[model samples]
Target chain A: MHIDLHPAGTAAALAVLGTEISETIGARVSALNHAVCAAHLVGVIETVPAFASLLVRYDPLLTDYDALCAQLRRLASGLNDEAAAQGRTVEIPVCYGGPYGEDLPFVASHAGLSEEEVIRLHSERPYRIYMLGFLPGFPYLGGLNERLFTPRLQAPRTRSPGGAVGSGGQQAGSCPRESPGGWQLIGRTPLRLFDPDRPLPYAAGDFIRFVPISEREFCALEAKKEGARP
Target chain B: MKILVPGPLTTVQDMGRRAHAAKGYPECGACDKYALALGNLLCGNEEGQAALEMTLSGATVAFEKPALFVLSGAQANATLDDRPVPMHEPVRACAGSTLQIGPFAEGLRGYLCVRGGIAVPPVLGNRSTDLKCHIGGLQGRALRSGDVLPIGPEPSGTTAESLRHAAGILREKPWLLRPRTAHAYLENQVIPLLRAVPGPQQDAFTEEGMRAFFSGLYGVTPDSNRMGIKLSGPSVQTIDGSDILSDGIVEGSVQISANGQPILMLADHQTTGGYAKIATVITPDLSAAAQLRPGQTAAFRAIDVREGVRLCRETAQQLRYIKELTIHA
Candidate 1:
């Protein structure tokens, strides 16, 4: 449980829990985040967990930087690496190809696989959520199969619709809102990834599984509210 | 209140959404937080009350009903109905009065606080408009012509007791509520000298690169926005390469891009960043940094993190002291 600590800003410090980007390192980051919150370390206003680091925001009025560093060091030492504490799984329905997935064929050719093969390789496995940051509810998903791995587009797209499932640099991401992106978008999901009404739909350490659906099914799901699908 | 002419990037904001960063939501709020806080304070409002935060440009708001409002941040020429009104000093506006604010003579962003506060229902526990996602504020967007905003009930208890002051007559203050942070952004103010602390990835920079960062005068690039103040000047590069596994980004982080430009992350910055950060302008100066517009030159001076923390504490104390001092007003 070696942690490298540095001052993030005047009010906060970052705890880099791991060096490499992997499930093991990510788990350690998640555990340390949970431990610090569970312990209620004084002055901790918020914690932002990324690939293998957790940035803790604190109030200087309540606690200073040195005190926070020592407190985080103490909390990180007692963290359980293999803790069962995890976020719930979310199933996303995708419509690959045509208007919804303009880059589906491009991704298929880039990976040297059939369109069906690309979809299977992507949807077959569950990916762990790293953290949302680039856009609201935009999930940075890990665990993409090497067979379907493809590089980002040479020229980025000006605008992508909400629920765009895109891949770049050995990682896949879902766009919760329409925004400019540079990734190779292979498909689109009907469900709104970032509805404010939904009570914290996703978090770090959560698991995401993709379910493929026909265009007709996708339209039906899009029209229906979450959890009310026929 | 009705928006006759909307300002650029005008939105309802409070202190912002800070508690949910671990879940990946960046805290989006007023770029100049201290200005907003002081504006709310002058209006006899709480620290976290929603206020209209306008950037670069100013908005034209027509009041259908009477309201008490205070303006702060950049200097803007404001008029009540057609008569000019003083800024920083509180004003009690009459119903059917139109308050037209400025083509800013100085500074970038300005804050407008009403007595009850902007009553827009908070999204994710904040009235702030997260422009990245387009949620919250008036229809999750900036103020537009013909949009009506409802102000909330004023909170009880105040120092100056601006809330209790009679509303029919314009209650104008003779003196100004000047905060230390606003000094750097005032018109005719010198090129800002921002005190900085080594960022999380300072080691990523080479010795010469670090020297370039400290010595060079970074000019604010036109690419700047509420998300960050992008600068292009002395090229500051890294030793090996400038790619960090995506990590959490601080609000005032000075991230150096592949092209060697410094991008100072502001209020609406993303929660995590992949670029290598060389330094962070400590708190108490972020407001000054937010007011920087394109073509403005800002230089960094390194300071001890402890001193930065101490100065931040002093700033907090100062705000409290102001609240008490206003008791007699």
Candidate 2:
């Protein structure tokens, strides 16, 4: 595999693995990211793995672009698929078709299916967390059923509550916080996707499995979380 | 110190949460690093120590103990007990004294650095306020009225004599501490020119689009925030539309949206974005870009990586010069 280095900025560089978007590209990107972090290169701050590239942020005073690029190319050559398979499958509890998911009916109608089928299809399999972006702890997931694909809302709500399980086009993920979003919301989770005190339970290469829960269970878990907080 | 009146948006910031971008946390910090570092240096605090970043307007604070503080970035009419506090200089605040920092007369953001940095418990290794995630800095939100912030213990080796001497200088001759160079906004230029290098996705844009980006005068939109500075101007036509497979983003990325408007990513920008970026504002010019307020216009000029690195080094040298000047004075 060959890596192409592009200047993201003065302090950062994007190591493009390939142009085409696929699981192979993502796995290679993940491997390079893991390898870079393990190497502990001087001045390297962090590595963010996306669909087709790995963004390496570093300090220019300690390391320059050419040096970092040469190092990145060496790491990319020996990448293995084991890094892709190492991610844990985190099960997330979700309550479907309620106040938390106001767009459930719309999504169901758009997909020509009942609300029950929608939930079953969404919760059937584990989806890969391709990357986290747009917001802190917000996962960009893949592996959604094509039959369940629904268009995003034309006018997104000004504030969508955190833990919102949403789908737009072929993608599906949870909103980590209360922010404006256009995704077709079909369910909600009580768990906090993002908490500063708690290390993010999931990462870029992890898989997220949605577990269907009743509204009562959702409230109980929600209250338990609130009570746990000081 | 107690906040009597929290301005429009004020948050505690440091150099930002480094090494956390991989987990999708924003590098939230002072929009203008030079200003924050200058204030911190003046107050004898570590360069990356936490300070208060006030946007548009400044806060009114009441100190419960004697403290040494400095105001920098965006000229603000600040006073301690109604006596004017000079910008970029350390001044003393007596116990029970109320200091009011008026709205910025120039630029958009200001930094308030006390000798001991703001001592909010760090989250993810940073004291910065991540407003969206509700993490770090005063419970991950802006300062509110009556909010009492803890000041960190003074750095070791700081003696009472040094504090007294430093505090006395402001009263004796405040102008001695002022930097001779004025802020770029204070200059007579109608539009600030930001130097940038071609971005990773420069090939995605058509020749006309690149021309528009370089030649166009873009006005900063009110919708701009710490996340990104949205600009409106001549439409930058693209080759295959502006959308790209989401890729990693960095501060100062000039992304052109489907509508052809440019959005300059800032400190709080997301880790990744889908729009095509045509250029990245150089490190030295990022502070200048950050200082641009809504309704102001800015132009972009292209430079190579060699020049960008040189400019970055020059800025560091300038900071060192300021630190030495302050020490001798």
Best by TM-score: 1
**Tens-digit lDDT track of model 2 for A1-230:** 67888887788888887776677777777778778889999989888888888889888777877888889888877765444546788999999987978889998888899999989999999988888888888989988988789988898889889899989888999997788988999888989767766788888888899999999988888888342211
Between which residue pairs do clashes occur in model 1?
none
lDDT of 2: 0.83
Model 1: CA > 4 A from native: A80-87, A95-102, A214-216, A226-230, B159-189
| DockQ for all candidate structures vs. native | 0.67, 0.61
Residue B6, model 1, lDDT = 86
TM-score of chain A of each: 0.92, 0.93
Q: Per-residue CA lDDT of candidate 1, range B5-103, in tens?
A: 888868888888878676567688888887888778777787678999887878999998888888888888989888897777678788888999987
Q: Give the least accurate 10-residue stretch of model 2 chain B, judged by summed lDDT.
A: B175-184
lDDT of 2 by residue, B1-329 (tens): 99999999999988888877777888888888888887887777777899999999999999999988989888899989989987876788899999899999999989999988999998987899988777889998999999999999877544444544554654465443322222324367667788888878898988888998998889999999998999999999889989888888888898999999999998888878899989988877778788889999998888876667667776777666555545554
Which has the greatest DockQ? 1
Docking class of 2: medium
Interface RMSD of each: 1.3, 1.2
